[model samples]
Target: MSDTRRRPRHVGAKLLLLILVCYFLVPVWWLVVASTKNAEGLFAGDGALWFSGFHLADNLRHLITINNGEYLRWLGNSLLYASAGGIGCTIVSVLAGYGFAKFDFRGRNIVFAMVLGSVMVPLTALVIPTFVMMSNAGLTDTIWAVILPSLLSPFAVYLMRVYAAASVPDELLDAARIDGAGELRTFVRVALPLMRPGVVTVLLLSVVSTWNNYFLPLTMLSSSKLYPLTVGLGLWTQLASSNNGGGESLWNLIITGSLVSIVPLVIAFLTLQKYWQSGLAAGSVK
Candidate 1:
């Protein structure tokens, strides 16, 4: 009698999970299908969710060749920005978080409270203020304008603090101290290894945020040569929408560029998946 009752609940949960899977995957499937079609086929193709023809190669060729290969330049800029910002932000967050978790100092609560408060404020709200500061500092239109602002992620710091407090134990640090390990040595040799999972999580989040950043870069950079993929693709979209010429052709290129832009992020996630898997295994063993 109990078995019959549990069967329906299990079946219902599986059905719900299947529905969510389809909901997320449908758009990706559409993107893949649309990338294969020309602009005309994309809008007036035989099916919206199915491939009409394969023009992906021609579109990619044009994507790289058009405007002296501007798309490639944008791709490189994004890579540089994301890699630099992500790694820098991860370092800052880890140090700040570890300090907060392990040490006690006057005004610590007050400062951490301010950080937590800042997290509630939307990043878009701060762009104008950031632009003004960058302007005053003579950094506007330079890579520093974008990269500097991205290096401070309050949320990442908060995440690291929470993870550090939970994952790192006071007893372990005390043991390291009794063994004559200095604070720096203790952190690098003992605490850091245990914090690997949190570090990787924060790293991936920072990387994705920097890679997809658009509005801040848009506000800060005016030169097309300095534009990242987000800003560059946005420019193509705006130009394509206007009635100058070659609207549909540009649209095709835009679709292909959008598809190409996501490849690096996908590759990064897949490549780093094993680190997370190993981290989980280590945690389980402990």
Candidate 2:
């Protein structure tokens, strides 16, 4: 009798999930197919959504060789900004969250409420104010302009606080305190291990956010040398679109470069998705 009841739900869920998978994968599949085509194949408009010819290698060679390999520099800059900023953001969020979750100080509720409220505010709204502050601090048009603003994510902080409250046991912290462990030491040695899933989850979110950031970098960086892949690719597309001459056909490079840029993010997400899933599922079963 239970089997009969469960069968419909299972089948329905699988159908829903299959639809979602196709919804997301179709765009990626189109990108992959489009990336392998040259200008003629792409603009031919007949096989735009499928693999008509394999010119991926030729496109990649042109991408790498363009303007003395500017794409590689952009990729490296993205890695540095995303990795460093993500790690820094995770550390700050975890510390602030732990302090909030474990300790009871002045304005605790009010402060947490404020943090929650801040999470509701979009980063886009704050960009102009942030730019002004960065300008006053003489940080405009520098790497710090991009990196400093990314070091604290209010959403991550709220997430960490909630996860730490549930996942990290008070008993373990008390035991560590009893053993002459300072708050920092306890957090580093005992509490952090139990919250690995949460940290990894926050870290990956930070990485993705930093990787796809375009407007801040666009406003802060005036030099082509410091541009990340997002800005650089946009610039290339703009330049190509404005010029109709045969010498300036760069749609293939832009498409191929975009495909290459997303590869790292895909790898990182696939590698860390298990930890993120575990974090989300932490208290569900219990």
Candidate 3:
């Protein structure tokens, strides 16, 4: 009886896990297959989940050469936005989190409460107001319009605060202070090293956030030259579906571009996964 009960639970757990695995992996498998086909092959009404032809090379060439190589420019813009904005956002989060976690200031709790409250608020709801403010500042349709707004991330700040509190010890900071180290010096030399895991985590989060950002860039930028990969691909997708009876449909390009788009994110995680893992371990070491 005992073995039978345990066996059923184990089977159920494995079945549930298999379902989840398929749920995520199936789309990826379909994309891989769909990306290898032309419009005819893609919408051929069969074998979408199975590779039917080898058009990956041809699709990639068209992807890069289309619209006079605008895709490359869009990719460059995305790189600039995600890398630069992520770095700035990570730094701000770390500093703010460290201050919040370590220091005792007037209205500290109140300020943190407000920050936490902002986290509960959806970023989508703020786009219109953010756009209005950017418009007033005369920054619309420029790269700055997208970059400036992403610099401040409330969620990253909260993560850093928790990490700083847990990873950094007050006694060490007090010792550094007694040794005549300035606040800035202590943070740079002492606190930062101790909070590496948290910093890495926040950095990764910020990068991913900026990378996948579509709505803000869509609303802020109007110039095609300044569009990032997300917005650029979206425009192509729209054109493909616009049904103007163009020379050929662009569903292949869409699938292929999307596949290309995710490559960076996959590379990012693969490159940083070890560091992220280390950071997580450090954060949990206490």
List model 1 lDDT by residue over 66-174, tens digit each.
9999999999999999999999999999999999989999999999999999999999999999999999999999999989998999998888888788789999999
In model 3, how large is the Cα lDDT of residue 45? 91
What is the C-alpha local distance difference test score of candidate 1? 0.91
**C-alpha lDDT score of every prediction, in listed order:** 0.91, 0.91, 0.90
Score candidate 3 by TM-score against the native: 0.95
CA shift at 171, candidate 1, in angstroms?
1.7
Worst 10 residues of 2 by lDDT: 240-249
Residues 180-284 of candidate 3: C-alpha lDDT, one tens digit per residue: 999999999999999987888888888999999999999999999999999998888778778542435677887898999999989989988987887777656
Off-target runs (Cα >4 Å) in candidate 3 are: 1-4, 245-248, 278-286
RMSD of candidates 1 onward, in order: 2.2, 1.9, 1.7
TM-scores of all predicted structures: 0.94, 0.94, 0.95
Ranking by lDDT: 2, 1, 3
Error of model 1, residue 116, in angstroms: 0.7
